[model samples]
Target: MAVTRWIAVAASVLSLGTLFVAPPDAPMKKTDAFLDAETTGVLGIEATECFDDPAYSRMANDRVVIYRPCEESADNQAFGFVYAPDGAFDRPAVAALGWDRCGAAFGKLWRGGSAEGLDFYPVLPTAETWADGDRALMCVVYRPGGKLPGSVLPLAN
Candidate 1:
């Protein structure tokens, strides 16, 4: 399935509140490092670090996103955050919004250079979190193959 379709389907499923059940231990705290990560900090995520699958998956599930410094490899490299408009958690819509935002940011970052091997994706919020007032969309840039060695941001010549 296309990424947008998959995101829509996942959003629909999560809206139903059924796939993942919270563990019976302590209630998850919002202050967890992942949950409390600021946009500035997230923007620093690069080839130096990456988000594991569990963390990347949680991005759409309204859960804290765990990240680790890239040792040998990683799933995705976070590069920035997009401020999604305040509204219901509509995955496809938010994804589009995020893409638009990321596109502009990417243009500024790359100065119109070709992003031939790189692609951008958004980590959007779940309906529950939307209702509870989460409006940030994490944006990431990654190569199709796998892990990167250093920051993806283009440097001045």
Candidate 2:
């Protein structure tokens, strides 16, 4: 789906689920780290450390992990999650589900009026990764031509 359309759908579904932002002291999951590493490799962005701003702690669901780069100059925030399906695994189906899930959650924050200028998109599991049983999807949020100052969670508050 187009980014704008997905955002619209996501805004409608924001209130559908409970949202949780990971506490600063919480341990980072290996999956979260893996997503971070993979994203760096895939996007070719140089990030030496995790973003640790107290105001912008990581966010997670039971399966998804959203992270950001530490560099104050970075342009976007990223979310990674395993997209396992109950039945046969189809690429399009998996992508759609992952996309919507990210959209809904992020949409919640955006609809709350906290995420005014940011945009988001998902990077889905490639065929090679899927063959190896990796179903991770990374959702990235960003503001065009700008840097984020803090967490969207708090902005909503």
Candidate 3:
């Protein structure tokens, strides 16, 4: 409870906090706002299953904490998806491409009623559109600790 003891404790906490405490290890993707904004412009999100890599668990009943698949669409009919741990919102879309969060475009996507998220490709890769469209899509939720693939783009907000 002395001054020096308190200072040491605070310093220790800070050191541990920065060194030890960190964001949960989750699969991430990137979307470059300047280059790949079309695929990264997520306007909506839809919840799917919550499961580990190569498997999934149905969390349909849990509304408080649902797994939302980031539904993205940009100009020229581009579509993409990003996974959300909690609820869905446009702010989350911004968060997905923001500097703090993943800051990358999500990979592995569910097209219509497909089984895999990485099955689809950029709809209009050669098109020229600054904004994005409004389309419902599902993105691949990569396994924790897995690095982004070569195809996935970085999100720059």
lDDT of 1: 0.59
Better of 2 and 3 by lDDT: 2
lDDT of 2 by residue, 70-153 (tens): 445444555444356655567678767766887786776567556666666555665666676666676656565355554333
Answer with 1 or 3, whichever has the higher TM-score.
1
Residues 1-157, model 3: lDDT tens digits:
6999999999999888888666776544323322222333222223232312111234433112222322322112123453333333353354333322221332223323332333222211112331223222333333223422322223333
Top-scoring candidate (TM-score): 1
TM-score of 3: 0.22
Q: Give the backbone clash total of model 3.
A: 24
Clashing pairs in 2: none
Candidate with best lDDT: 1
Tens-place lDDT digits, model 1, residues 44-102: 34433576544434445544335656554555566677777765667678767877887
User: Which RMSD values do the candidates have, in order?
Assistant: 16.5, 19.3, 17.6
Worst 10 residues of 2 by lDDT: 45-54
How high is each candidate's TM-score? 0.54, 0.49, 0.22
